[model samples]
Target: MKEGIYYDCINDFLNKNRDIETKKLLLVAEYTNFELKKLESYSGEIIGAVVPFIVYNNEFFNKGIISCDLEEENNFLLIENLKEFSIEDSFFKKSKSLVVLVDGLSSYISDFLDNLFQNIPENTQVIGGGAGKMTFERDPVIFTKNQFCKDSAIIISLNKKLNLGIQNGWEYLEGPFLTTNSEKNILKTLNFKNAFEVYKQVVEKDSGKKFTDDNFFDIAKSYPLGIIKYDKEVIVRDPIFVDSDNNMVLVGDIPQNSTINILKGKEDNLIKSSGIATKKAMEQIDLNNENYCVVVFDCISRAIFLGDRFVEELEEMKKNINPSKNLFGALTLGEIANNGDEYITFYNKTCVTGILC
Candidate 1:
């Protein structure tokens, strides 16, 4: 592995540890809605340098995964062949790790993930899941400027010594325990009611807030969903969408047959959870040496809830992580982490922090 941070306009930061040319890099960036062209233009340069597996965007304007090559020469083929390319086809063989970028409508992510990991190598590590949807476009190298166009994702594969660790903590409320009647990645029903409705009921009853599409965030953002693991151990994930029809709310995938409970959160608790996540990641690694990178998948709800105080958590992570290491991450619709078992767990309403050294 090569050592040192390579920062550029197109490449925000790259920590190469070894002289591995065939580096497996997993890169992800989220941009505002409908800005795929601008986002892709810059991402094209980033992945072109590292040879990414596939780039993804979560703007679920349609029904399938859009596919394309990084090079302009294959632009026509990539878009035209998108339907033919399953999410698996975008990932080539010899992939050592994965880099991902996401923003825009995050609802489609779970749909992509259920299929994406099917053929991935068992040992592969994930590197990126950076913040937000960008609407405006800037140079591939420069990351300044904000535009809300479309949500997108980019993935890269790396080959070399790589490590990743994730930590998250969610407070589970005693009430709001509900059964999952039907589900998919972004859509689900709880107690035969739409996710939004159930949420409305809870908030109106407790907080006296009305549930409406416009006021969904007033009650729904960072809402927690509890899951029953195989051993009956419980974990919570957050919901990302509220489908009006079928009375089901859309969320990242919740394994079938798992019991779900809706949990509530406060701003202070969310920040504390971030600290806990950082500590957990640190606990996973040796921590005897300087780290290379730390990627955070904080729920956007946390950011919206915390506002200015959010940077405190970032600084805390920077201090806890060796100052020599680089840290970057995004507020995502859903976060994925390994639970020290065969499964790479997906979470919502929790800070999913991953450190790579």
Candidate 2:
């Protein structure tokens, strides 16, 4: 496997690597600030998404494109409609890992992943992310070399299994609140009261910070909603903003009638959890085999919450891995990974890593 990061543009990178060896190329790049065009006479397939930032080695950046060449037998599928994606059973049978990238701004992902996880076998590991710009404006994020798309998802089936590490360090701040009136990703009413109003009452009292229109995301990142699932599991969901109806729009979906907790994070705990996640992945890696690739789907909200100390979170992950191996990933709008022997789902404000050997 080979990869490189370009700061200026992808056109120059495509021009430079026209003689690339593999047929599978992934272009994980920063949002639509760069110009793009199809390579004339190019025969290779390209798949990737636009993200807020790209993670490479020990550092992260906002203005760059990271292109990689896949080394295994892989199949790429583009789901223009997440609710109705189709594939034969042989597709998962032939794949050892599934890299799923979906539109971050869409509310259909939770249901989409639920159906997808049921179709795949236990031996198959899954990882990927929600693709969108930081500005939260609707635009094309997931794509092929020629197809710039929206309201879509791209599934890349790779023939290599993965060692996975997944963790989120958030403790309850309030809530045992009931999601009474919710639809898709919109939290309309919690416990039959206005969702945003209930959230504001708790968060303001806890942090002594008012939720202004401008600083909603900045404050909400530290205080997310946690939905309780079966087997003592809790999934985190980020409330990005409030809509005109005072509905809290979350990054991931929560069905109505679910129990939720308002979660809060400490800087130390969040950073340490990221390190623990990497350590778990490292533990699963074969010691004798020095060759492996690290791909992460970390939540973009974590970066905003950590602010200048976000480097500490990156350094924690870097500290556990072998310095010789490349640590590559994206600051996704949400994370995708399968839970231990349970099922796969979309997550918010968490870190999911895959060790491809």
Candidate 3:
């Protein structure tokens, strides 16, 4: 694998890695600095980039990068048409593989993965995040080597071994309310009551705090919804906004009839869980022989709730993983991972670590 890092914008990526011969490139950029619309008209072999809060060497920075492979170009496949991906495709036959995804639309990611996992081999490991800004604009830019796009996603297949671990420190606060009514990412009701009313009541009761329109986000940041999964795995769903009708809009989708619990967390627990997640991920792979990089897709909500203490979470990750190894990733709106047992899932307010070798 060949990698190049640049302090400049997306336009400078090719210049920095001119000598690297690669068929597919995985780009990670600072969300604030990247322009998504500029690459829409670009005409080149498919290459794509994601916008997230980037991490490197235990510090957060806004640097852009292009990671590519020269010799493994044949093993790499750039998938644009999610509907067209199939098991019979030569790309799925590889022995050990990793899929890096940069999705322009978070809503479509679940659907895309549903189709993707059905065709890919069981040994394949997937990692990536929803690429966009907090603005929640209609056109979030995902870029290619020479083009930018909206409402599209880039899927890169690489022949490599990856060990993944997922963890969320948020503790369950209330009942396993059945999702009585929901539409895509909007929660209309919980246990047949107005979603916001139930949420507000539960939070106020638990925290002894009042909820106002002005302070909703401040109060809601520490309290998110957890979707129960098999083997006691809970996928978190963050409530981003409350609609006029008091319906709660979430960062990711919550399926109807599914049981969910309200979750709450503290700074100490959140920070402590980061170390546990890192340690578990590192334990999955043999570090002595392989060249590995620890890639983390941590929820941005955690950082917001943690404030200055967020740095302590990063420090925990660094300490748990081999201190000499490279640690880098993005603070994402939503994180994606599949730990072999569960289906590949999209989660909010969670930490996902991938030890890629």
Candidate 4:
């Protein structure tokens, strides 16, 4: 295991670590640190992506680079064309688990996830997240040692299975509305009516605040939409804006005919949920490998809505997992994970924790 540390300057890191080609480099950098000048100057297999922020040792940083070494090389896959995402059948033949990262703004990401899970070997779990900025500007966010890509995804297949936990503590506040019209990430209608109209009726009455065009997100962040799966946990989605047609534009896709409810969150319950997710991951740690690494895909919206209190979310996580497990995480535009025995999908407003051996 190579040392995973933060470097403030890309040139400083590139100059000091010039000999890093011997090992597979996993580089997670802030959007400011991303530059692909002279890829030939460096060597070896590299997995790099520009994210909103990276979390190491439970500390949050909006800038700098997080570099470490990864396990296997041949199994790593980079899907540059997300709209027509496809992989050979032989790719996952030797994998036990997967770490996935996709561009958050990609329209075809949901389809990609659906296809990836349906075709992959059974019992192979997936974790990781959507990479991008809070502004929703799309670019070459996903990268490898040689190629920088956008509207893309990168996957690292593992020989070791990861123990996982996924949770977002937003309590239900309203009814089982139907998504009457939807395509990709847009929620066009709810319960056969304008999506924002129905949402405003519920949210305004509950929060005692009116929704203006400018303050829609400021008011809507506290009230997200939740979709319920049969016997599994409820998955949450964040509605970021209301279009002129009153459609609810969300972070991820909300399939038509899906049953959804408006959910409300508090500062305390959200913080507690992090600890619950961490403990759930820790409980499944293999007895043979008592020590495991921690990886989290936490939603960037959670940090924005919580503001300074976001520290409590990380603090709660630190209390549950062992002090020895090295924690690596990112504040993603949208989260990607699947709790065991459930469907793999893109998510929002949730914390995804994985314990890797």
Best by TM-score: 2
When 2 and 3 are scored with lDDT, the better candidate is: 2
User: Cα RMSD (Å) per model?
Assistant: 8.9, 1.8, 3.3, 2.1
Any idea what lDDT model 1 has? 0.45
Tens digit per residue, CA lDDT, model 3, 13-47: 54554554445455565543555554443333436
Which candidate, 1 or 2, has the higher lDDT? 2
- Give the worst 10-residue stretch by lDDT in candidate 3: 1-10
Per lDDT, what order, best first? 2, 4, 3, 1
Kindly give the stretch of ten consecutive residues in candidate 4 with the minimal lDDT sum. 22-31
**What do the candidate models score in CA lDDT, each in turn?**
0.45, 0.82, 0.71, 0.80
Off by over 4 Å in 2: 1-8, 25-27, 38-41
Q: What TM-score would you give candidate 1 relative to the actual structure?
A: 0.65
What TM-score would every model get versus the actual structure? 0.65, 0.94, 0.87, 0.93
Write the residue-wise lDDT of candidate 2 on 1-357 in tens digits: 333344446666667777764655454556435544654445576777888888887678787677767655677778888766776677777777888889998878887887777777776788888999888988888877677888889887887767889999999999799999999999999989999999999999999999887889878888999999876678999999999888999998889999999999998999999999999988997899876778878898998898899889998898898887777878999999985456788889999878887
lDDT of 1 at 61: 14
Q: Give the CA lDDT, 0 to 100, for residue 137 in model 3.
A: 60
- What is the total number of backbone clashes in candidate 2? 0
- Writing each residue's lDDT as its tens digit, candidate 4 over 156-198 gives 7877778888888889899889999998889988889988889
- Model 4: pairs clashing at backbone N, Cα or C within 3 Å: none
